[model samples]
Target: MYETFGAVVQGPRVEFHLFLPDNARDPSQYFRGGSPRIKQIHVRGDFQDAVGSQNWSLDQTFKMQRLEHPHGWLYKLAIEQDLNDGYYQYKYFVEFENGTQRWVSDPIAKYGGNDQNENSAFVIGGRHTVVHPIARRRPPRDLVIYETHLDDFTAAFRHDKTPVDAFRERLDYLQELGVNAIEFMPWTAWPGSGFSWGYDPVAFFSVENRYVDDPAKPADKLVKLMELINDLHERGMQVIMDGVFNHVRAGNDPNLGFPYRWLYQVPSDSPFIGAFAGGGFFEEFDYQNNCVAEFIRDVCLYWLDRFQLDGIRFDYTLGFFRQGDAGVGIAKLIADLHQSLNQTGRSNVALFIEHLTDNRFEAIRDTNDIGAAGCWFDPFMFKHFEYCRNGNIDSGILRILNANLDFAPGKEPVTYLENHDHSSIMQEAGGRGRWFKTQPAAIALMTAPGAVMLHHGQEFGQEEWLPGSGDGRVVPRPLRWEESPLGGDAIGTRLFGLYQRLIAIRQRHPALRSPNFFPFPFNHPEGYGAFPEQDVVIYHRWGQAEDGGFERFIIVVNYSDFDQRIDIPFATDGHWEDLLNGGVVFVDNQKLRRQKINSNWGRIYYRKA
Candidate 1:
């Protein structure tokens, strides 16, 4: 179905197709007289016209025929010639019946120019030379994701803008941190300022040339991106790309000769636009339209096929729904995308969504029988943060700890304490200006029974609020690696060492990664300390043992400022080692071991056989 739209290249002949909605062409529905007549479709590239001139002249332009379809008018063009391999850019030149003409980029191009100027380009017979590493599949439950903006991570060390290749140079450091996957924020081409979170995607298929050393050679970016992916894959790390399909940048008006006007809608009565919301620059995509659907599908497929990415994290699924609806179309779109990607033989390719709704999660669960991964557990983070700051364990914390068991069984939710959107935990903790206080939160996150993630600089304790263009916005900011714990700072060093130990323990222990969470009973008179409602939380993670029993781990946290003692009942009377501090304790009586945990610290005890 996607083949019905966009340009399809076969040998020396290239076929082009464009769909103009019927309503858009109607006189009364759009412009007063009528929509543009689309007099001609013109395409020019390096492979066309001359051998190496790559010039676009009147002689190079050819006329395209308009065919009638059920959807609307379809402009078709077939060009045959002796075109060579490499980078080729093409655009559509259309003349209106009213004698107005405009040059527009190809909406379906696999590559394009920088954010300042959008011109679609693609590789002609250019094959990837880098041998991809053998595909290694890890269970969703075992994933330790590290999310970062590529430029932010690399630019922190360099004076100039960091490119994808420059970011790749830091793979060894990531591998050292023991993160299994890296989630890069939206890298697609966007307009206006180069420093951004990259959520405003103007060209979905093209790489952001702001990070590219050479914008003239479009294929160079593609090659460098591939190299980075291959390098990551070889290091046994998966690559997850952040995708923004909910909306497009809104400045392009139809009257301005923008070709992709049909992709968005700017209704006068749009509720999303207001003084508080900056007049709504995000025009929701026309997902109900077939042309838009195919375009999105092609964009997904292009990255998956070209770069062999491991997964895609779609931004804001709330925007996917139509007005006053139950998001039936949104569910179908996700299901269809999952099915299509699986059909590509990359069945292990993960699909995640940022839909902050319980109904959306249930819908995705119902649609994806194989189980679709959900967003980061925000409630868990918030509740834990509250407990840390207030030094109180409420019902909210208990509910969050037991969420997976009560709500969605057998599904692994991505968990995180801090991400690119909000300020770091240190910043939220009343500007403690130290990462030491956040250790308990970090322990809880890594030890939680699900896939976990750490935002860039979180491991080394980045104290500054995430850099962004404006106040409270996700603009680019310099990452001061010199202040990092790994940079030999005492406080940062302690935090980094603790993180490394916690992550290594999580990776080694199967019980911590298990979906089965058994909250330790603190109701017993002797189990919980003097105050059961104090700032102390305890739980147990277990998995089936080889002997058909359970391999259990007891996790105890002291959120209070002073020291506390937790008398947790052991599954068996034996020696238990504190996984955190590496101290071994012997339990003679069946009652259990009483361990004294330090203030603002936690301990993970694994019962020795």
Candidate 2:
């Protein structure tokens, strides 16, 4: 430690300075508070029985000469030297009237007990700077996304040093599953709990302490997590982090009135609810509060700048909307957040909003039109699952499809059959008895319009229902990395392979991923053609002028028990290949074509160049 000190004493102010370390950028050379939960720190020292200012500042050279002093304050404590790696013990000394000095340390130190003698310590590491370009780019419409939680991903396998490498190993499985993006559940730091599912993050600036063993140092768990992320990007996968910006845990002391003294909240005099959503679960702040905006903005920037994450799926986004042009609509916050992030001079990270409201789509459409975030098309997923899984496919499913095709002009909405909230598809609609019935509906979900989401292990029929109430959200489901095909014939594996094939096809054919697709009139018998029908629905993606323009593809779904014959009317003079079935039908002119399909086989016919 390079130790030096200077003092120009005064009553309410003083000048205290220290020498800087030779290598400032070295991670292990710096000092870190033990708990990731602590944000702002307050340190005070005394001299001649007088108390001094607790607030401190550090300059770029790690030297501070002048500092504001409170009245009756005289002597001040300063950074003697840049802290080195490993645990070091230090405390503030207060000189009393009797010439006695008292030493004190932070009360919130992690290594707790009656022993304040050994002060808090932090291990250090090098900063992470690598980022992926595709994270923030405008993606294709036909994306297959997987929702995952970091703690859950590693918890089941973390015996010795396995959690870090375990996630790395799973990357192959995710790629095999054919997902374009992986949405992580909350993994931020939380104070009281076995696992928080990252919802109760105490420190917005730091990565979750639980995931990283020695978060203070560069060679610790946080760095390992970064390695996992970088590895994922190398494989051409997009990653989205779940961002929670609504509330924080209750604080023991109130500084700015945000429950925890650490968070900056709008003063109660401001025109907003200091406490909202009853029982003070979510505190409402005045959007006029600049500090509030600054805090969240810093958090956003920190992740994008540090971790190189691709996107952020904001959780409970509707909770913070204020009543003004820039602060009123949830859209405004997202728009502003995206704009600020763009100034970082890096890849643009995608934004997605999640709110439990019918009007949520309105905000998404408005903001996305101006390039804020992509649409979260949950309603479409809900309706499809309801029709297919519940065995209630009828006019209702058609209504949903029509609305989606009409409302979404140039947006790629995220559509999913099941997510973390609805843990199990079988349990949501009915019971285990209804599991077999919903299998056909799952197929429709994968093939239907817009972006698609698949919960982890949902493909191979792993049904683990997460507890809805409490901290159990972070618990991982028993991952069947061990593939178990249904009936020893690998039926589940076959279905997963089918999904993989669709993803490959979508990636290869740009039209499948295009946002501009026109729906054709499917006049099948019994009105089941496009009414949640899997046999005879036709969809077309009008291609851009660069690729010879306007590609028309017909998607036929044969959900019936028997094979069907089609005497369809088409004005095409070329060869057509079936996407689902392994066969080709040549149509030199407008004529009828006949084909056979399995019970739940979905066939797509496209023109071959």
Candidate 3:
């Protein structure tokens, strides 16, 4: 039925390898053949042969060669043309001499595809998926990220709606809030009793069918998901999916086998270490093996190539890397993947890791040197929660902040006040009462440092927790629509307004986005105001404004609550306008503004002059 290419006969169990065809320029040239174009490229082989056709426009025309050899044969791809600059998805079909055609996946992907029973490979050309300079060029320092489950976010805006309609309804709402990016809990399909966080997915390559138009066809579902992504892009929204590679769903997984038992790691000598949230211990991938590494790499490439996704948030870093000599370390895994992605010539995508371990800052920091864009910092949440819940500063805050200061500006960490996992916990702790005292801490979370993320429903002050483990006991996670009866009024409105104004201000000013601190002397151990003690964090952004105007602005947040005058020092001596308030302040003479400040609400002074 499909266009026919030649086929190579091969034995069923022989090991075969395929690579991107290389061409040599001269004697000095070490390559083999020219690269292949999807419209023109073709391959036929022994066990399996796949091609990275690079044909993006058509669905079926993009499908390239499929070959199989009954004897022993290997396949190599030669692409004589280039597809210019764009994203591409590729799969291989193997037709045996016995007249049986099969789909073979790319063994090189970080994570494999769901459509192919075997493995479908993927790669990005001259680009890797990264948050663009425009998207985060001027990120809001003070962010009130509303962490919403993708399903819940859609469901909240709909009545008797299908998944397609639900996703379509929330696009404008998400854009209206001016969230820099929306972090969706994993959308990959997984079998569940009902609803799931989507952490235990067997089909990493496919979007969850629950949200698709057909909800039955994998190919059709994938196309629908892509359409949703295109719509989001049209609206100028970046999408980040929570990736759970640490575990897999049993029975449903075909790679591991039906009624799958190899998905979990159990010691031969003892019992299970702990039960995984998705009903399995963990599907441990042997990272040391080249095959395993290739599989993971392909998975990462698939999403970037297929959907043009902005970024990926690795759910649990601890589980990915095993704990021994033979085992691969997280640093190595991240570095290798980063290097491979860098080949695509795209801006470095934000690679954020969830380092929940208190003392593992070093381990996480090393990821940067290995080419990671950044990491998720929990210290922001802990300090804020400690102050909110216990009404006191914890020693842990100062220690972690000081240690984290080692990182250069704009590359420190991904900071957030609450997420789906933690919010659920906070809600349960409140019992009949409020989990976190409705206060100004939300303001502080947005202004803190690194890349910021807001959990869904946070803007609406949604206080219900989703049913799950991890940190669900403290914060509640549920769909609380912005204007619904279940949502709070004054508190939610105030917080939402604060986030909007702050985000707008940050978007207008660059200095506020990438901050540089200038510590002021403090007498006591505890911080007097919102910031850490003596840390009078300052920032300087060097560049022309978006409108091609020269604008210089400075942000001063006094961490001390009591009236304290600190020397204002800078190279330029001139009159600076306090943008937050319509007042001119002398910066040359260090004219300190003194005032009584509240314990939680810190003072922010911006320069206009």
Work out the TM-score per prediction: 0.84, 0.72, 0.65
Clashes of each: 3, 14, 74
Instruction: Write one digit per residue (lDDT tens) for candidate 2, span 8-33.
Output: 22333333431121112332321321
In model 1, pairs of residues that clash are: 468-475, 469-475, 485-492
lDDT string for model 3 (94-131, tens) is 33333444333332322233333433322223223332
**TM-score, structure 1 vs. true:** 0.84
At residue 409, what lDDT does model 3 achieve? 47
Per-residue error for 293 in candidate 2, Å, reads 1.1
RMSD of 1: 5.0
Candidate 1: residue 488 lDDT (0-100): 77
Candidate topping TM-score: 1
**TM-score between candidate 2 and the true structure:** 0.72
> What ranking emerges by lDDT with the best candidate at the front?
1, 2, 3
Best candidate, lDDT = 1
